[model samples]
Target: MDDGKMVRALVRAALGRALRCDPDRLPIGLKEEGGVLTLQGEVPDIAAKRRALKEAAAVAEVRRVADQLHVKPAVRMGDGAIRDHLRDALIAECAFQECAVRVRDRGTLESVRTPIGTVRGTIDVSVDDGVVTLDGSVPSLVHKRLAGALAWWIPGSRDVANALEIAPPEEDNDDQITEAIRAAHERDPLVDAVAIGVRTQSSVATLYGTATSEEQKAAAERDAWCTLGVDDVVSQIQVVPPTAPTRETRTA
Candidate 1:
């Protein structure tokens, strides 16, 4: 064998080692001339194609590895099976793996609601042509990220696309505050029913009414401050005297 043939053999051997396959098992033919190596072979899979090229490049004496490896297709997954596999993958993810996250038989949606007042409603998990798409909304930024993370774990997914919105917490309006104040007044022992008027503006409030005692005045002020959206307080509350006396004229 000439020096060129020896160099080609060394290249093939190094590649076979990296691939963990027998050097003789690979039916790769090599052509070498003027330090350039030409490779011709049919690889069983894409892994073999990569291994062959890598081995050739690692050869110090060889200037180039010309790859001509044809790849063969192996097993094919059915559409329904692929979808089922992806569903299982999604379920295994830490975010959605728990018993709380459950998928419907139709696979149209998944729902997860936690005890922390966070809600995830109607997550649509679907895969088409190896691409996975998740559509849903959560109550906060944390749950939104959780939903996306869950989608990525799906098997056979070429790519995952998430379309989710975080819903803001609902706000209580003036009517609710008024109702709460009325309820508080009914519960308090010091408050005179229907005698106090609680006036509000954009949740900021002012208590301008009369009360029988100083304690009642303080309680009314406390109630007004606790109401939601009350920014500033203007207490014009007067404490009425329990007893009234007749007017008498006196010389000073």
Candidate 2:
């Protein structure tokens, strides 16, 4: 077999081997060129989307995996609503307070500048279908990752195409993802991040600690996966309900 065909086969096999992806139901398509494989299709959820990308990138012949995968939204809405929400998310984000916001409206772009301070950079948001694309640039990799993570949080966001580039092009590592995950946990009211500890190794985040309930545990896991560069999430969180305090009776 030719090199191209062999690489494609290996990638497909890798995806099929991953147990969490529900390989039987996965309808993702693959394309390969110059050792780079591209994944294109709709996935059930964010977990499945990240899992598919990780599996495809793990192939020996695949040097990099391009993500074109979209997660199915829980609720359906028009493209305009998605654009507005994504734009608001960027503006309201404290880290992005210095960044300008723009949106694509009926082919015309509406620009919204922050009055707080000088514009460090801009984040252009455009939504097509359910996919949200972030363009322009940022001051550092941390800002880029934070913007990407926030985009994924918007409801009905099928996929976040984070194209935000760093102005000075800073180096990146697993620490970036770990920090992003921790920040996400802190931002999310659903998660009680005080008891949860985060550790990242090779793009995999392990969340270990205790949650008050099952829902909180799951929320913590979801926060980890939402961050960019997260290949997989290892959740070691235990659920322990809070106990009522018992007071000793005083004898008169």
Give lDDT per model, in order. Answer: 0.56, 0.83
TM-score of 1: 0.29
lDDT of 1 by residue, 1-252 (tens): 778978977986886787677887766778887767887765554335555666687788889877555433233444355556645544544444322343333554545323245434445556555444556554544344344433333333333455655456434566545554554455456777477777666655666768989989877765554333344456788898566544553332
Error of 2 at 200 (Å): 1.4
After aligning candidate 1 to the native by TM-score, how far in Å is the CA of 231 from where it should be? 64
lDDT (tens digit, per residue) of candidate 2 on 168-248: 787889887788788888888889988999999998899999999999998899888888888899999999999856565
The ten-residue window of minimal lDDT in model 1 covers 96-105
Residue-level lDDT for 149 in candidate 2: 75
Count residue pairs with overlapping backbones in model 2.
0
What lDDT score is found at residue 66 in candidate 2? 87
| TM-score, every prediction | 0.29, 0.86
Give all candidate RMSDs, comma-separated: 28.4, 3.1
